[model samples]
Target chain A: MFAGGGKTVFYPKKCPRVRPAPCEFPIIGVPTGEPLCTIPSGYRPNRKCTYMDYAIETNHLSKNYGQVCAVDSVDLHVQPGEIYGFLGLNGAGKTTTIRALLGMIRPSSGSVQVLGQPVGPNGRGPWRRIGHMVESPAAYPELTVLENLEIARRLQGVTDKNATLRVIEQLGIAAYRNRKAGTLSTGNFHRLGLARALLHQPELLILDEPASGLDPAGVVEIRELITRLAREQGLTVFMSSHILTEVDRIATRIGVIHKGRLIEELEADKLIEIRARRLEIKTRDLAAAQCVLSEAGYAVSANEDKLSTGDQRAIDAPEEVATLLVNAGTPPTRLAVEQENLEDYFLRLTGETI
Target chain B: MNTFIASFWAESLKVRRSLITLATAGGFMLLPIVGGLFMIILKDPENAKNLGLISTKAQLVGGVADWPSHFGILKTGMAIAGFILFSIITSWVFGREFADHTVKELLALPTPRTVIVASKFVIIGLWVLLLSILIFAAGLIAGWLVDIPGWSSALLWSSFGSYMLIVGLTYMLMPVAALIASIGRGYLLPLGWTFLAMALAQILGVLGWGEWFPWTVPGLLSELTGPSVEALGIHSYMVVFLTFVVGLSATIIWWRSADQSR
Candidate 1:
């Protein structure tokens, strides 16, 4: 039924992440193949264009499979040299979002700007600067680890064999360089994939589920490598993952996608703000706790031994929670407070309380 | 250029994992050796008299087959067995990728889709060429023991030009295997489909034009049979080459269009 990639599908007007007003920036810069960086007057280019600063920016992007919307008019902006974590649950369109960004499939409607250029832009030059290993550890099994890196390295125009070998060892796969990629263990396969991805030292790396089949130790090793690349090498990384801890640990900024739409785009610090207010209290007169919290503009939800207010400004949660109960003739038992982290924010943004 | 070489090297490595390809080569080498043994057996005077051949040690032990088929055994056995071996090895080239779920890795590479498709064709072409050489070499080796005359090294090498023209036709078998591999879920379906197509070509061949028919050409070319010896020509080479290029190009383009990337 799908042929010619014909008849662009229309989506509804509800674009949750669209900016109220389009911001136009001066197109003056060192021209480096950004899709929208410069457009000649009186000439029409392809559908995709380059954005001035954002490595990737998608406006109203959506992909619907039958009645089910796999990506629902999601908007995303990833800056260069920043590791942005795409956090989501299973079936949350994390992979779909990554796929659309990479031009792996056509969007039903909307636009995608990748590596500062609109996806499918003229010349296809920007892709040469981008490296991606998607969904699984994708590499040629028939090739040795070094051979796989060599192919990618040559394509990306990196002339130094020593540089590729440097990355191979950096990824801790030098010992397995001669082994067939298909014969390596799952974790080693991932290491080899990473070595290939970093061969050209690509400016932007889009890794979908980067830690597939890695153990905790392997994840730590990978996480450390990612941190070094982002911080030391200034390589921008866009990673999608189902694991909350991985996202929390490495993402410079976090975008949680759920059911193909973006649940929220906030800094990792912001999510911790949402879930981190761990309130420990010293009180027994639980009856007045709600009234006391409400008096101070705190919306409190109480379930037996505990009560939580939704926001930080609502109360100095612990102090307010305790003072109210103690003043109502009940001396408290204990009180403590901690801010929300990625896990709490992840659950809150997806609206799934686990 | 480096990219092409790297990919070519990568694909050649994939063959090691497939026992079918190994078996195909092994069987081809064994065929000539076994034929020599059979000639050795026939010279024992029991079977030689039945075939009505004169028994000079020289004439009886000629190249693996040593002489003409008694309208029965040698030619039929060699053609059928050789064709089956090529088909068997050819069946696995594209078929195994879908079976093992490794096509995903292939399509995801950043290179153009055409490059990926051509890599498989290069591999298949190489195998077909190598197998043709082994077959020709086997005949010469067996012919040695019998002291058969007219073992022209010149004719054998030049015959390859004609063989490759037909070899061009045989290239489609891989892409057809690739097409089935694309749509069908596993190795068995592509293998079954390839085997069925070859069988159908045979059924059609029985009607009249089977020997010169495009699909059956590889079998006949491998045999270098009676009428085929005269019918095989420079023009036949071009026809097979054109047919093969058209068929393979169509299959590869269709394969490139499919949404195989995961």
Candidate 2:
């Protein structure tokens, strides 16, 4: 059934701020003729369509170009008000999955539903609520920054004229508002792209490398902006990035895909918890330190100039290793424990060295 | 209706801001100005030669200096040069989205992709029609400035009809340009197709089979190659209409179903 026109089915547990419809069920968990909450304003939710909890849900979604599998049997469930970071190496099917999610590309096999509506055979989806920036941010270079955002705002069916101005200030492209987009710096161009995505105040923001061309400060600003939106406005963000640090900073949950398969999916805290930790002890007497640590029953190895251990005991008690080294007359120059960062963890998971 | 309005507004702003709009307008106006200069030369050939305005080596303007001659020049220019200009406009209208990599932005909006495509076609039609009117008006001004004789309401109305018919035929052929722009995903391929079609139109027109070729239909209707009635038959229009439907459907289908991997 087409969205926005059908018999009401099921009850509404938490009604979105839709047009109030008189209901015999007392507006409790029943789908009404009114628009669904979390759907962008222009959309008309099919009342007969049952409610779905997840903002984005996919089942066994696979996309193959010829014999090469671009995405292989991926199932994803992203809840509302969550920031799900999609991580992958270059050519790792992150983009393919994103395109599928946006209905920009068809799935070779399987299904995708966004905001409870099936995605495209002809660019059909819950697009009103979904603002996406796929791959590089492409704008009509001949147009000014403001004009570009205005276009986005109108096409996204945003009736508010100030929406474009708000996003321009938010993305800090106000200075370039009147300048042709082709002439903007890469960072500003990226800002303009982001501004366009944010113009409609969407419930879901699907960004691919959203910070690709930004400077360090610009990257932090974007990170903060995304974090604020998801926190304050209850927005859902499904962003794909190869920049591990960027994902680590903002992503609440991380899904790592490699060679067209999702290798791991975990909460950010859980990812940190599972990352390898090592104790490194440096001394003037490296040989003496190694022997002392080895004799102390720590699984010690040499990494370049320092003696390191993957032993949990050594990691848990760096003081113990330090005391042993000092008591052996090889006073430690440095002693510290280091946990794997997202980059190291990503590289390790992808079977690559730092 | 709302989506169409929004899409149309967006499409209009892009065209209004582009340098191509001004460039095409300037290029289109040259037809009338040149044709008027030819009328002046033909009006007084001896005086033009003495004044170095028309050298002895200058080519003849063919038709006598009158309203019909002026209208004929305008009509023929609309058919020949208008095709290229119209193709360029069509290419930019559809091709710029891909050239600028903005097609993705348009694809997943609340507005349907088909609506967006239709809006572009509407804007393209309006833009070309506006240019046709501008050129025709410029032709009138040029004729008045040249002070050509033999003007009458009947001749004027008939000329207007012929001019419009020629332009309508040219406009019908633009969908092929839109299709090439879409499938090629940029301006170059469509522009290349335009040049190829123009070359083929000349070849086929010379070979006495121009009536069947969609690209040559406007040239035939212009009555520059032969009598309009003989140059075009009922089947000629059918072929043009078929090309329009096929090109338009192909563009929409490509937008609807093709993988937008780019």
Candidate 3:
């Protein structure tokens, strides 16, 4: 759906596909039911855009083993050049969904589509255009890092032999290229896994727990690399991770899954919008502070050693809360506004509060 | 074709870099060396007595010091020991992927899972065949060193044919080990399967039903106890062939259908 009714096509003059006449645009389906812009034909088309603006789309995708459902009816839409962070706890169906998307497991019901092609039975899909690493980083322990990547590159149908060398340098594992994979440290092993995923210069990268063993610096490096791939190359990334802060920092959009179901999905900016913030106050007489804030029409509760209110009025004006507590003879000892971080939000959503 | 080549290369590299390769080679080398030792022990009874219990055991095991008896030792060794060694090779080829957790990396790729599985089988076949040839050559060298009597071109040709046939039959049974390794996803189950098969082969062969059982066919053909064609027939070959087909098809189906949640 590139052009709407009676709307003139807006073609960029500098577009590489600009011809002497007019550039032809194809009408494609997007989940949002809106028209999408067109890129040059030779350029990697929006991987997320087929009939929809989604590189990966699933409808009622569910997988059950015997009586237990590993992945419930989950709907996902990952747009091109957008890093969609799948946040979940362990056994939360993140890996199951990733496996289904890659066609590693047959869904008990529903379907999955990637890069505009349905993932066929027995793990057949548009794999040439998609790169992925599921679960743990795995390599032939007896083979060197370079050898392992060379295999991945070849199996990925990459013609250039130098791709292995390029990815090795790109992941900063050049020193260990000649070292056997079994000898690598955990972080470097993860880098080798990432290098393998990026070996074919795929348009879509699906990774599960990609940062599991990386140190803080390595995490940052991978984040920056993913960000650059999405920004500069228009790559689509669908990644799952338990590390909420890491996902929050790099993902354009995030989906939280709990107990084999997709519970929540939102833009990264909206994470702050939904996160619960509060005005917390400490006083000599907590009950008195609670009464005073209650009298001011703010819903207050006594929690542990303090009185807290989740009202925006109290949060925006903590000084007013302090003054009200003082006039009521509570004499506030401490008063401050606090906001919940992504981890807290995630924990609360998953009903695993700390 | 490109994906096939790539997958073949990957499987070959893993096989080449593995210690199992050298380990299996060294293990098979024992067959010829032990055969040569038996010949030396059988050559002279007085010297054999001076050599202690080893000579007595060799005399009991090997009847006479000659090219026929020596070749018989080689044939019997390949038939019996080949089962264990070839099963170990098949187990390592398939099981090591799961042991190393590298199977996941192989699951979703431009190369089909069937191609990867086929490449592994091809590598195993080539490796087992090469080892068979190597051990046969070693046996010939050992026979020449011992300078056993009854050496003739006709005997050599007959012995070589027998050696190759027994080795082939042993190799034919190894795909079952591959299937077991794939289903069990590690070394233990396949090794267990090999031992169980060997035990059952012995019992079945003793029960006078060796021809019908695929595992017993190799041992019967090797004729370690003496030529007893009454317990075996042409159906024995058919049974072994069917077992191979079944094991191979089951392995491919498992790779294609099983949920690789691990």
Candidate 4:
């Protein structure tokens, strides 16, 4: 029984009833009973208001396949015109989440709203305004690139006959327009897939592994295309990928899901700030350099035969570290201040290597 | 209406470009061609035996090389071969999306999944119907070329009616193949179901319960069991129609509701 004077309270102690508070926020994992003095920080009093403000929103969205939990309670909010990068390892539920968002899969619990419309009960949604490419790009293999995009255009109800040619040119697959899709290379196949998704000129794009098979130049081209779409047309993009560096370059915001849980979500600038910065010094006498740094009250660790320290003092004044190491008869061979890259940060957060 | 038209156009394009379309058309033509070959063999058993077309102990399957016997062969061929060929078309129409990994493209579209599924069924139906007509025309030509007797407008009309009825009944059973292909997500399972159904129909027809089995009803109507076999009642057509409804509804429901994780 959750009873309070106008404002519902969750007790940290005693039997805290896990029910919807007066604010309509369900008390997740909170114990039942006694009126608590303060509400938990997880509670969102204006969740409905927040939902309308987002282009794509999911509250406590979960999906399970028999015994395996594919996605847990994932609350995600993607703002309009933002390139929200969803990073996860293989089988970490990135595709599952994309499928649920696209209304291709029914979530076992919770709900998904895309463009202010609920996604299901009959796979109904604002699909006309939303374009999605799930998992691998697929097309009618027997159909030519133009024909495939033409089919996509017709199904999307785009009356402009030129829409197919425009997307073909946009995705740089114009050269292969007349070629059967089955004859395309892997990268071109991916481009065709992206072309179909962009053929509709949708306001929101949800793509899974958009750059899975592209060459380096193709990857850059797709990244620039997506970035331009968001900048000029105000397209909202929610893309899931294992390519962390790619996501790092263009993503306005980042979400890291590990093992079906969104472990980290932050702005791009915030990610840059939180990434570990360290002063790395490579010396012939590693033990002496370590000892000198340790004696100077700097936390030191050996990484790949390099004496590494995260001390602000050492980073700010590398000359002082050099002077100390030179005096200690162990002149540094290599010394540089290094900030963690996205790959390093992702590995550190997920504890898994790319 | 526009969405349905658009989806239908899309489905038609896919079917037109697929090699399976030509393959099924060619495969269905074999029914009439083979029936013609049987009429040729039955027309001159001793001469064919001397020419090595027939073995010494081989007996002709169809009794005579007349127009009536030719029509009978065509009807029987349509019942059995039509089942297999139509099943192939249905399986390919529904299963190729999954096989080619294009089902996801159709899932989240302005065109509803129901419309897409219905369009695919219509395409399959139209394709098999055209093949049926082609086979009938070819059968008529084959009967004429063999110079068989019993060529009359009345018999032709009646035989065409019976032949179309067999084709209709065989086509009605194809939705089950489409349903299986969707649920199974490939050609192998539906083709496997087709074979299993064929085997079961043969077994049940031999047991004199062909009228009760939907798969056997077409063969029974074609008189594959025997002309003297009791005529099927209204319940037989009702059962086939019921199967058509169930399969169509189930396929549509699966497309609308099943989690298309692929």
Ranking according to TM-score, highest score first: 3, 4, 2, 1
Query: Comparing 3 and 4 by lDDT, which wins?
Result: 4
TM-score, predicted candidate 3 vs. hidden true structure: 0.91
Candidate 1 Cα outliers beyond 4 Å, as residue runs: A1-51, A66-68, A117-125, A140-143, A155-157, A276-304, A309-314, A317-321, A338-341, B12-21, B37-65, B68-110, B146-166, B209-213, B220-243
> Which residue runs does candidate 4 get wrong by more than 4 Å?
A1-51, A316-319, A331-333, B51-60, B226-231
Looking only at chain A, give the TM-score of model 4 against the true structure: 0.82
lDDT of 2: 0.83
By DockQ rank, best first, the candidates go: 3, 2, 4, 1
Show pairs that collide, candidate 2.
A4-A45, A4-A46, A10-A30, A11-A29, A11-A30, A12-A29, A12-A30, A13-A29
TM-score of chain B of each: 0.72, 0.94, 0.96, 0.95
All candidates' TM-scores?
0.76, 0.88, 0.91, 0.89
Best by TM-score: 3
Query: Candidate 3's residue-wise lDDT over A1-354, tens digit each?
Result: 233443322222123322222324443323233434444456643333324346788999999999999899999987665699999999999999999998888899998988767895475888888888898789887889999998898888889989999888888999999999989999898989889999988878999998887888888888998988777666789999989998999998999899999999999889888899988888888877777778789999899999888998888888887777778888889998888877888888999967
Model 4 alpha-carbon miss at residue A54, Å: 0.8
What CAPRI grade goes to candidate 2? medium
Residues A20-117, model 1: lDDT tens digits:
12322223221222222232444443333322446678999988777988999998987665689998898999887776776656677898977555
The local lDDT score (0 to 100) that residue B189 gets in candidate 2 is: 99
Complex DockQ per candidate: 0.21, 0.63, 0.69, 0.61
lDDT of 4 by residue, A207-238 (tens): 99999878898799889999988876667899
lDDT of 1: 0.63
